[model samples]
Structures are given as structure tokens and as C-alpha cells.
Target chain A: MTLHIAVLVVLLGLFFVLPAYHVGAFSRIMVLAIYAMGYNLLFGYTGLLSLGHAMFFAAGMYGFGLTVNLFGFSVAPAFLTGIIAAAALALIVGYLALRTAGVAFMIVTLMFAQTVYLVILYFGEYTRGDEGFVVQQAQRSFAGIDLTGETERYFAALILFAICFLAVAKLVQMPFGKRLVAIRENEERARMLGYDAAKLKLHALIISGAVSGIAGATYGLLFGYVGASFSTVQYSIFPLLWVLLGGAGTTIGPLIGVIFMFYLIDISSGYTDAYLLIAGVALVLLTLFAPLGLVGTLRKRAFPWLP
Target chain B: MLASLEGAVISAILVLTAMGLSIVFGVMRVVNVAHGEFFMLGAVLAWVVTTTLGGHPVFGFVAALIVVPVLVGCIAAGADRLILKRVNYDPDRTIVATIGMLYIIQQATLMTYGPEARPVEAPFNTRLSLPWFEFGDEGFQMIWPWGLSITSYKLFVIFAAIAVLIALWIVLTRTKIGLIMRATQQDSDTAQAFGVPVGKVYSWVFGLGAGLAALGAVLVVPIQQAHYLMGGDPLLLAFIVVIIGGLGSLPGTVIAALLIGMSDGIISVFFSPTLAKIIATFLVAMVLVFRPQGLLGRAPS
Candidate 1:
């Protein structure tokens, strides 16, 4: 816990010391890291690998974006609506998807996500289809502070990230999180011990979805744009990649993974247009050499008490 | 009627692609997420061959039909040896590796193909009108319909797919390689003990699967334009077909492809294409949730 707080304190300190460009980049990474953290809860701890998490993220995004645009909702209510939308979606999807395990689960989630994406496209008049609508700068202010400003946006993102980070950290150390890990390690054994595996998984998915929704809502609110592109399979894969790279089941790993991937792409795009090629190669290499991921490898090799 | 014909063509292509995926999944127990990329590569390579040949369209098309699959098969085999073998084909790692391959392939194509949707000229295209039979006072006379017609190329696709399926059936059943492949699929450890080269068989199966997808793409490229992004739809549709048909069942795959392809075409006629896709995707997910073994697959022991 102290280590997590120290990490947050250092992040706060970095905002003041770092240059302008990095601070902005750090803000975006922090937001994305929250999404990764949410993904890790179900995937890392619960051992459910979903390929359609973009649906939840987009649920929050569209919920927030649509309510604000169509209904003239204030930021606070719009954000709540986004999170609720995601939670509701998670409830339905989790209930259905949890029926199938392993590869089928992956496929089910992937197809459901595809349906969400298509639905978004079908209602192009309202959602504006592929070309998404921008959240207006005028409506972005909350509590007498404009979120569009760089400093304000950074702080807003930081606050959200810190909250989620602490919650997930605390949750993982709790008995509930331990049970989830138990389920992950051995579902049959966990069930034999009288734990309701289905209900536990469903609850975990909802919480994970809500956290992802929070990130999604905050992302649109802070960055001031919501688009259907964020709902793509590519977007779904991003969290998986981040979680895998950062070390699944680790509290701070998602943040490290997000930052690592962000800079890898950012730095590579400067040299070539085919930056995704570099990412692909990195992924292949990681699977080959670092299957456990950075944090996972660290835990395995040294500092077993790190988590 | 037109929608059914179009669906038949789609089903034909889907049979080849989905069959490829099914075979690989059955034998290797690894889902190649890059399967669609291999299909895209086939279409792209077809374009390259046809354009560069600059001869008769038939000659170019024939050359592509013969050469593209072989080339793609070799590439897939190389990938299997390099990446898949190293990972030991663990299910999760295979997915990630294939996704990485997907990115590499897609990005490379974007860099080379330049993001344009390029069309390949069919070897031959002739519009053939059809007669409608109607009972009249003059007694059963065939009347020419105003709008009922199909191109020679579309009909050819249907025939080509049938020919390919027949040939594939024979290869899988009648040949020594087929026997080996079947043995490996049933029990790789036992087959290996019996002196079957399991590793080599895996590489060949991977190659064959990719080759089949490439062949499908080559055939369809003339009908639909070759584009870097065209693989996504086929991948999703093939996945749906594979799951609905029951994994690894050849006949099931063919039947499911027809069912799905026909519905996709007919649904588009009644509803918006996007709506059709949403419905299909949702229904397929429901099927997997309820009938995880698929429509024809035996329940796992």
C-alpha cells in the first residue's frame, strides 16, 4: 500500500517536473492504464480472457457522449450514465458469455463486441457513425474548472487514475480477490469449496466493466471526443496487449504496460509510417522471450512480495 | 433468386476459407487469427500477378490461381516453423502471436498496397439471361424474364468451389498424406510414437490451411475488389461459419457456410446490411453460448 502511494506521489511529482509534451502524453497513458487495469481484474485474476472489452469501453463512451449531446446532460450525470451503461452491458454479456469457457468465451465476447460496433454504425444519424462527434469545449467545464486545459485535464485524469489504482490494489489484496485468484487457478476446486463460481465471475465482470466504463467516460470527457473507432476489435486488443505486457494480476503492471506501449508506438511512428510493424514484432518477441511480462517476470525472478 | 445465387457464390468462397480454418483447428488445436490475412494476401498477390503479367486476363488469372496458393502456403509454413513452434502452440500464446502476425501482415500490406481497393478483371464475364416458367392459356411456355440473369464468372465460382471441395474430399480420404493428417489429428502423441513426423505434419497442415484461404481469395478477388481491409468481414463470417458448423466437421462447415451466406444475402435484401450483420453476429454468439459443441459436433468427453 505504501509502495502504491509512493508511486502516485512520484507521478504527481513528475507532472510538475516533466516537460509539457510528456505531461500531456502521461495524462493519456494514465487514462488508458485504467482501462488496462479493469481488463486485468477479469483476465488476470479471474482468468477470463475476453476479446470484446471494447464494447464496455464504448458503452461508457456512447452513454456519456450521447446523453451529453442528445439530452444536454451535465458532465457529472453524463459520466454516471456512461458507467451505468457499461455496467448494464456487462451484466447482460457476462451472464451470457460466462456459459462458455476458454476459446468459446473469447469468440462469444468478440462477436458480441462486433454486434455493438455494427449497432453503433447502424444508428449513424444519432451516433454519427464512423466519423464521431466531438464533445464541445464549452460543456467540458465542471466545478468552475475547464477540463480542456492541459493542466486541468492532467489533474482530472490523475485523480481518476489514482482512485481506480488504489481500489484495484486494495481489492486484489482482499479475500474476494484471493477467491478470484483461487477460481482462476482451479475453477473446479473453487466450486467444490462451495463458492458460487458463476456469481463471482459475474460480479467481477460487472466491476471490471464499470471501472472500464469510468475510464471510457473520463477519457471522452477529458479528451473531448467520442468515436466508434474506439469500439473496434483493435481497441479491444489494446487492453489485452497492455495487460499481457505489464504483467497480468499485478496492481501497477497495467500502468507500466500502457506507458511502455505508448512510448514504443510514439517513438517508432517518428521513424516510419508502418509503426504497427514494430508493435507486431515487439509482441512476437515478448511472447517468445517475456511470456510472463515485465511485472510477472519480476515477481517470478525477484521480489515475490512486490505485489 | 438473385440473392440466393449471390449467397451461393459467398458460400462457395466461405467453404474454402472456413474449411481451411477448421482443418488447422482440428489438427493443430490452434486458431490462426491470421487466417484472414492470408486470404487478403492471396487477393493482393492475385492483383500483383494479373497486373504485372499484362497479358490476357485468363492467362493472368490462371497463373494466379496456380501460383498464389503455393506461395502463401510456403509463407505460412515458414511462420509456423519460426513463431508457432517456438511457442509450443500453447492456445493463448498462439492467439497473441497470430494477432502480432496479423498486425505485421496488415501494416506491411498498407505500406505496400497503399490502402487502395484494387479490382482484378475477371478472365471472362458474360451476362446470361434466364427464362421463367409460367402456366398460361397457351400451355406451359418459357418466357424471358427482364431482370433475372447471372454473370458467367459468378456461375464459374460455384462450379470451381464444387470442384475444389470434391478434390479436397478425395485428398483427405484417398491419399496417404490424408491418412497421416487424420492420424495426427486423432492422436499426435500416438502417431508420433508410431513414427509419424508430427512436427512436419503440423507445418504442412498449417500451410494447407493457409493455402485454402488463399485459393478462396484468389477466386473471389475478381468479384470483390482486393483491399488491405477486406479481410475483416470474411474473417468474422468464416469464424461464424466454423463455429455454427461445429469445429473440424467438413460437411458441417459447408452446410453452415451455405446457411449463413444465404441468410446474409437474403437478410440484406429485407433489412440493412449493417442490421443483417448485427443479427448474424448476435445469433452466432447465442449459438456458441447455448450449444458450445456446435450444431454437428459431438460433445467432448
Candidate 2:
């Protein structure tokens, strides 16, 4: 817990010390890390590999985006609406998807996400189809504080990240989180021990979805744009890649993964237009040499007390 | 009637693409997310070959039909040897690796091919008018209907797919190679114990799977323009077909392809294309929820 707080303190200090460009980048990475963290909840701890998490992220984004854009809802209510939308989506998706396991689960989530994407496109009048609408600068304020200001946005993102980070850290140490890990390790054995695997998984998914929703809502609110691109299969894959890279089942792995990936792309984009090529090659290499990921490898080799 | 014809064409292409995915999945037990990229590569390579040949469209088309699949097969085999083999084909690792491969292939194509959708001229695109049968007072009269014609190339594609599928069926059931493949698929460790080169077989199967996707793309390029992004839809549709058909079942893949392709065509006639896709995607999810093993797939042991 002291280590976690120290890490937060360092992040807080970095905002003051770092240049403008990096501060902005750090803000974005912190928000995305939250998404990756949410993904890690189910994928890392629960051992459920979903290929359609973008829907939850989009659920929050579009929920917040649509409510604010269409209904003229304020930021606070719109954010709540976004989280609610994602949780609801997670409920429906989880109910249907949980019926299948393994590769079927992956495929089911993928198809559902595709359906959600298509539905968004079908209602182009509201969504503007592929070209998304932007939230007005005037409407994006929380309790009279302007979120568009760089310093304010960075602090806002940091606060949200700290809350989620600490909550997830605390949650994983509890029995419920341990049970989730137990399910991940061996679902059959966990069930035999009288734990309701189905209900546990459902609850995990909902919490995962709701957290992802919060990230999604915060991302749109802070960045001031909501687009359908967030719901693509590519987007779904991002968290998986991040979780895998950082170290699954680790509290801080998602942050590390997001920071590494964000910068890898950011740095590579300076040299070439095909920056994703670098990401692709990095993934292949990571799988080849470091399949356990950075934090995973660290835990294996050096620090056994990483969490 | 027109919808059915269009559906048949789509089914023909889908069968080839999905069969490749199914075969690889059945034998290797790994999903190649890069399969569609292979399909896109086939069309792109076909374009490059045709543009360079600078002769009759037929010559380039035939050469591409013969060469692109082989070329793509080699690439896929190389990838298997380099990356997949190193990972030991662990399912999760394979997925991540293939997704990496997907990005690599897509980005490379984007860099080289650019974003424009390029067309490959059909070797033979003469429209063949169809005669519709009418039951009237005159009794059993045949009338030629306007705009109810298909390009000869489309008919050729249908025939070619049938021939390939038949050839595939024979190779899988009647030949020694087929027996060895089946043996490997049934139990790789046992097959290896029996002196089968399982590693070599894996490489070959990956190549063959990719070759089949390439073949499908080659055939479809003239009907639909060759674009780097064209692979996405086919990949999704192939996944739906493969799952609906019961994973790696060949016959099931074909039947499901037909069902999906036909329904997609028919649905588009009544609903907007996006709406049709929405319905199809939702239905597939429900099907998986209800029957995870799929229509013809055996229950997991």
C-alpha cells in the first residue's frame, strides 16, 4: 500500500516537472491504463479472454457521448449514464457470452462487439457514422472547473486513475478477488469447493465492465471526443495486448503496459507512418521471448511480492 | 432468384476462405487472425502480377490464379516456422502472435499498396443473360429477363469453387496424404510416435490454409475491388461460418457457408446492409450461446 501511494506521489510530481507535451501524453496514457486495468480484472485475474471489450468501453463512451450530445445532460449525469450503459451492456453480453467457454467465448464476444459497432453505424444520424461528433468545450466541466485546461485535465485524470488503481489494488486482496483468481486457476476445482463459478464470473464481468465504462466516460469527458473507432476489434485488442505486455494478474501491470505501448507508438510515429508495424513486431517479439510479460517476468525472476 | 445466384457466389468464396480457417483450426487448434490478411495479400499480389504482366487479362488472371496461392502458402509456411513453432502453438500465444502478424501484414500492405481500392479486370466479364421460366396460358414459356444476367466470370467462380471443393474432399478422404493429415489431426503425439513428421505437417497445413484463403481472394478480386481493407468483412463472415458449421468440420463449414451467404444476400434485399449485418452477427452470438458446438459439430468429450 505504501508502494502504491509512493507511485501515485511520483505521478503527481511528474505533472509539475514534465514538459507540456509529455504531460498531455501522460494524461491520455493514464486514462487508457484504466481501460487496460479493467480488462485485466476479467482477463488477468478471472482468466476470461474476451475479444469484445471495446463494446463496454464504447458503451461508456457512447452513453456519455450520446447523452451529452443529444439530451444536453450535464457532465456528471452523462458520466453516470455512460457507466450505467456499459454495466448494462456487460450484463447482457456476459449473460450470453458466459454460456460458451474458451475460443467460443472469444468468438461470441467478438460477434457481439461487431453487432454493437454495426448498430452504432446503423444509427448514423445520431452517431454521425464513422465520423463522430465532438463534445462542445462549454459543456465539459465538472463542478465549475474547466476540464479542457491542460493542468486541470491532467489532475482530473490522475485523480480518477488513483481511485481506480487503489480500489483495484484493494479489491484483489479480498476474498472475492482471491476467489476470482481461484476460478482463473481452476474453475472446476473452484466450483467443487462450493463457490458459484457462474455468479462469480458474472459479477467479475460486471465490475470489469463498469470500471472500463468509467475509463471510457472519463476518456471522452477529458479528451472531449467520442468516436465509434473506440469500439473496433483493434480497440478490443489493445487492452489484451497491454495486459499481456505488462503482466496479467498484477495490479500495476496495466499501467506499465499502457505506458510502454503508448510511448512505443509515439516514438515510432516520429520516424515512420507505419508505426503500428513496430507495435506488431514488438508483439511478435514479446510473445517469442517474453510471453510472461514485463511484470510477469519480474515476478517470476526477482520480486515475488509485486502486487 | 437473383439473390440466390449472388448468394451462391458468396457461398463459393466463403467456403474456400472458411475451409482454410477450419482446416488450420481443426489440425493445429489455433485461430489465425491473420487469415484475412492472407486473403487481402492474395488480391494485392494478383493486382501486382497482372499490372506487371502487361499482356491479356486472361494470361495475368490465370497466372495469378496459379501463382498467388502458392506464393502466399510459402509466406504462411515461413511464418509458421519462424513464429508459431517457436511459441509451441500455445492457443493464447498463437492468437496474440497472429494478431501481431495481422498488423504487420496490414501495415506492410498499406505502406506498399497504398489506401486506394484497386480493381483487377476480369479475364472474361461478358454478361450471360438468363432465361426465366413462366407458367402462363401459353404453358411453360421461357422469357429472357432484362438485368437478370450474371457475369460469365461469376459462373466460372462457382464452377471453380465446386471443383476445388471436390478435389479437396478427395484429397482428404482418398489419398495417403489425407490419411496422414487425419492421423495427425486426431492425435499429434501418437502420430509423431508413429513416425509422422508433425512439425512438417503443421507447416504444410498452415500453408494450405493460407493458400485456400488466397485462392478465394483471387477469385473474388474481379467481382469486388482489391483493397487492403477488404479482408475484414470476409474474416468476420468466415468466423461466423466456421463457428456455425461446428468449428473444423469440412462439410459443416461448406453447409454453413452456404446458409450464411444465402441469408446475407437475401437479408440485404429486405433490410439495409448494416441492419442485415447487425442481425446476422446477433444471431451467430445467440447460436453460440445455445449450441456452442455448432450445427454439425460433435459435443466436446
Fnat of each prediction, in sequence: 0.86, 0.79
Which candidate number would show the highest DockQ if scored against the true structure?
Answer: 1
Candidate 2 chain B, run of 10 with poorest lDDT: B260-269
Provide the lDDT at A138 for model 1.
Answer: 84
Candidate 2 chain A weakest lDDT stretch, 10 residues = A271-280
Chain A TM-score values, per prediction? 0.99, 0.99
In order, what DockQ does each candidate have? 0.80, 0.78
C-alpha lDDT (0 to 100) for residue B166 of candidate 2: 99
Off by over 4 Å in 2: none
Residue A207, candidate 1: C-alpha displacement in angstroms: 1.1
Q: Please list all clashing residue pairs in model 2, or write none if there are none.
A: none
Predicted candidate 1 versus true structure: per-residue lDDT over A71-179, tens digit per residue: 9999999999999999999999999999999888999999999899999999999999899999999888898999999999999999999999999999989989999
